[model samples]
Target: MPSETVVLLPGTASDEVFVRTVFAEPLSQVGAVLVAPRVRTLCERLTALDNASAGHPIVVGGVSLGAHVAALWAVRNPDRCAGLVLALPAWTGAADGAPAALAAKASARVVADRGLDAALAGTTGWLHDELTRAWHGYGDELVPHFEEAAESVAPTLDELRSLTVPAGIVGCTDDPVHPVDVARKWAEAIPGAVLTTTTLDAYPRALGDAVQAWQRAKG
Candidate 1:
């Protein structure tokens, strides 16, 4: 609707190159710009989008930590957004036992112990098959990207309670980094949020379906 411009933000250890190759190709047909801001905070990224669009209806979305940022942005700028598309949203709160936090801690350990190379190697295996291959090819640059993402967003749950945007959440059943329960909580927390599940094999399908749904609703 209204010539949607979907700004896509990638999760930790990800950058615009990955998002463009993985997500933008399919999404661009719908007239989405797929704006991937390279910033340290969600607020700053949203500010950049604001300046770029100059007050247009934007559909914000992302993966993992990026999703968390998008959700926060939607809450803060409800009127400026058309919809939210969250894929593998991470945990954000005092809930220390959430899968997201556990994974973050585990990843932190990997980075600390085995080093970034080993960490990336291990994680590349755990990612979806497509992503794993892509990451493997880009292994040389993966660590730096992950380091930048880790320093980008500081997860805080209290800040999420303020969001009230229509959202669509997509997650993998086998993804330990983005557990289903955590995704469910995010869907429940945001007003008019919808949740969908997929296996590692169906990631692209899930993403396309979610984006289409959000676009239709925005119309």
Candidate 2:
């Protein structure tokens, strides 16, 4: 009856701060230790996940590109994954023209051609603030990280169906970049997966709902 460990990664151009803000309290409520690694690259995020699960099975999850990476890892290492808590899943299989991917690619170009401020100038509200902090934290690696995430592939529907672990997929109902339909598709493909909807302003609820879904599935 040991407490579970939840290793979460941030979205593209994001930092551990965002992960902690969204998942830490909810995971603590369920007596799970939260590991939010501050990583700028996909490889680092995956390595963090692998390292965290080396001792025992852990719940693996992330937001957007982070979610895609975590899901891909869980598909490959089901034995080391207890469950998933995915948020704002952007796409499946090939990223291609997925809105989130396209945005990342465009942002990368802006960052490369103009500057960080120019890339972020169009964003507003909470997203603006979040990106401002995260993009700044990325520093020299921002553009490359954005490009990598833009071109990254998520777990295919077949891969998701092959997963034996429970999954909790969350989506922002009004988010254009991370379509709710994508989350729905993920939930449908994964056995015993739960789909929850919430707004960006109440994003933390998405984590709570996801954890509750996992707990329900485990029970």
Task: Return the TM-score for each candidate structure.
Answer: 0.72, 0.95
Could you tell me the C-alpha RMSD of candidate 1 in Å?
4.3
Q: Clash number for every model?
A: 1, 0
Local distance difference test, per candidate? 0.63, 0.87
- Using lDDT as the measure, which candidate wins? 2
Model 2: residues >4 Å from true position, as ranges? 204-208
Q: Model 1 off-target regions past 4 Å?
A: 39-47, 123-165
lDDT computed for candidate 2: 0.87
Q: What tens-digit string does per-residue lDDT give for candidate 2 at 1-219?
A: 798899989988888988988888888888988899889898999999999999899999988888999999999998999999888899999987999999998998999999988988998987789989989988899989889999998999999999888788788888899999999999999998988788867754464567776666676
TM-score of candidate 1 relative to the true fold:
0.72
Q: How many Å off is the CA of 81 in candidate 1?
A: 2.0
Candidate 1, residues 90-195, lDDT tens digits: the string is: 6665435555555555666675677655655644332545445444554555544444444444335455555555667776788776777777776666656777
Cα lDDT of candidate 1 equals: 0.63
